[model samples]
Target: MTMNKIYSWQHKLWNKLTHHADSGANALLLKGRAGIGKLDFARHFAKFRLCETPSSTSEACGTCLSCGWFEKGGHPDFYHVSPETSANFSGEAAVAVDRDESAGRIKSKKKTSQQISIVQIRALSDFVYMTGHQRGRRIILICPAEAMNAAAANALLKKLEEPPAHVLFILVAHRPQQLPATIRSRCQLINMPMPDVVQATRWLKQQGVNEPEACLAAASFAPLLALTFNDQRYAAQHDAFIEQISASRKINPIELAEKMQQSDLPIVVSWMQKWCYDLLCFCLTGKVRYHLSRMTTIRVLASSIENKALAAFLRTLLVSQQLARHPLNPRLFLEEIFIKYATLLDSNGVKRSS
Candidate 1:
């Protein structure tokens, strides 16, 4: 349960932030792409602010009483807000409740919510308005802030509009645009930095990742996500999915959909999106961004794919991505997308095996 330490790429921003630690801005927004460690950065900054004695470099002293409480997840003055179903800060996978059939009785389990609720926001009033530990500064961190529903966002807006004394709000968002304009306006927005390929690849290597470059590219250059690519199970799934999709003439949409229905829908959609993106990219620029290991296959696929149809399918994938999070029938949802893709290839004269 160690605290999230600052990464090498964050040194410059860290110094600038710590230098302006008391700039009188009650609310700060750390907006960036996912897997760039925005949440970790926010957590580290919060720990530092609450530390009784920070280091010369403006980092939290790990041995301080405040740091101990923060690390133990019992800091009285610090509150973390995220979706009920999110494992955003815990560095774990969120598990969905499964139905139980025991004692010859069927029990239905309620699905965990993926959106922050108004109740969660209202509950923050007590912590925000109350005195801090030893009357020191208090911090409220909301991660993936866009998860707040409309009502919850409105409740939080009231606090940001008239923030209490000695309280700071740190919002980490992967898609800040999803947040309301007023909420964005109330905070001092900072676009979190992204590491270059060289820096990212170096860090991944230090993490003992094999084929770091390929993993990095597969994650669209997001280094943290590249770590997941190192997982053999996940890597195998991605490779198999890509192989089936690449051979459009041999794809069995229904069977593929059935096999993938048990997997994370949004993630599967993202995988397809990346593969199709490479195909489209190859068609247009004589290059492939992702699927570098399958360049020969991508080149052949790109040659037969109609640019207009491929582009249209890519747009369709965007809508699919949005609906993926809460699909009523996962199999049907995937089937529809895969069927469309098969039809697209068929229209391009990709004949199926007899």
Candidate 2:
């Protein structure tokens, strides 16, 4: 099928990756934020490589043998490897975010939809080594790249060093730092910018989200995530989380994360991020993005947090985003984060902590 609805930026990225798909480049790190169409870009790029028709700007004529298999997800030559845990989730794009459970929550079922492991890597490698059932190149896609452990990463590296003929590797990640530097260096790095407010708002509208601006502000401009807070379910959750933040400056970020493990992390991060973003606005211009929605709330919250505290708060939030990549102990990290948040806010005279 014609890629009639892809974002413009994705088009440019697709062309860049396509150039290497059929050439000497054996491995490609399709890097980007959760949204910004990274997965769609990769899927379409792989499709183009498998495309029967290769145009200067696009790929796959949609009528060719390659396109048909792709449409059916039955292509013998191509394999998509991602966290088995996230498999059932079918979004236009798939993103990786922090997974939190109580400091000692029940262990995640080693089920197919949770983590990307060495087993999955091994299975794909076996496929890539063997002959393809089709005439085209062999393609393997591993997404949310950070999900792989050291063992899995190394397994992938061994193959990267001695890649099979006609075999292609596409790795996608939200937090590339969690990936081994060796693994990252093996492929071309493509940065997918987070969609701006305008693009995000437009996408939200298309999704039939009411009060798109609230969701946009809630997501801090991340479109793929904007869809989550676009509804009442998420809106109420957002408000509840914010109240938790407002009530206790000593926030247990990891605890919160663990409590809402089955819930969406992007939304949690969005709530926290937008809170700081509002402080940012108030510090800079004394107004929040959605004055009609959360501006009043932010204004009251900001009154308790001056510029110095606001800056520190945002810095901690940024650091928390980085710490989130350490899948080692999500609970401790999150709790400590809120303690620090509470400490900072308390220092500024707000009893936001327990």
Q: Extract clashing residue pairs from model 1.
A: none
Per-residue lDDT for 155 in model 2?
90
Q: Choose the strongest candidate by lDDT.
A: 1
Count backbone overlaps in model 1. Answer: 0
Residue-by-residue lDDT tens digits, candidate 1, 1-354: 123678888889999999999999999999986667777788889889999999897889999899888777778888877765322332222101100000001111235454688988898888877888855699888866877888989999999988899999998887788789999999999988889999999999998999999998998888777877887877877788888888868989999998887676667887889989998999999888878889899888787778899999999998897666557887899999999998888777743332
Work out candidate 1's RMSD over C-alphas: 5.9
Instruction: Give lDDT tens digits, candidate 2, residues 23-115.
Output: 678888866656455666667777777776767656667788877877766677767766644232222223232212111112233322445
Candidate 1 is scored at a TM of: 0.86
lDDT of 1 at 252: 94
Residue 134 error, candidate 2, Å:
3.3
Work out the TM-score per prediction.
0.86, 0.78
> To one decimal, what is the Cα RMSD in angstroms of model 2 from the true structure?
5.2
Clashes of each: 0, 15
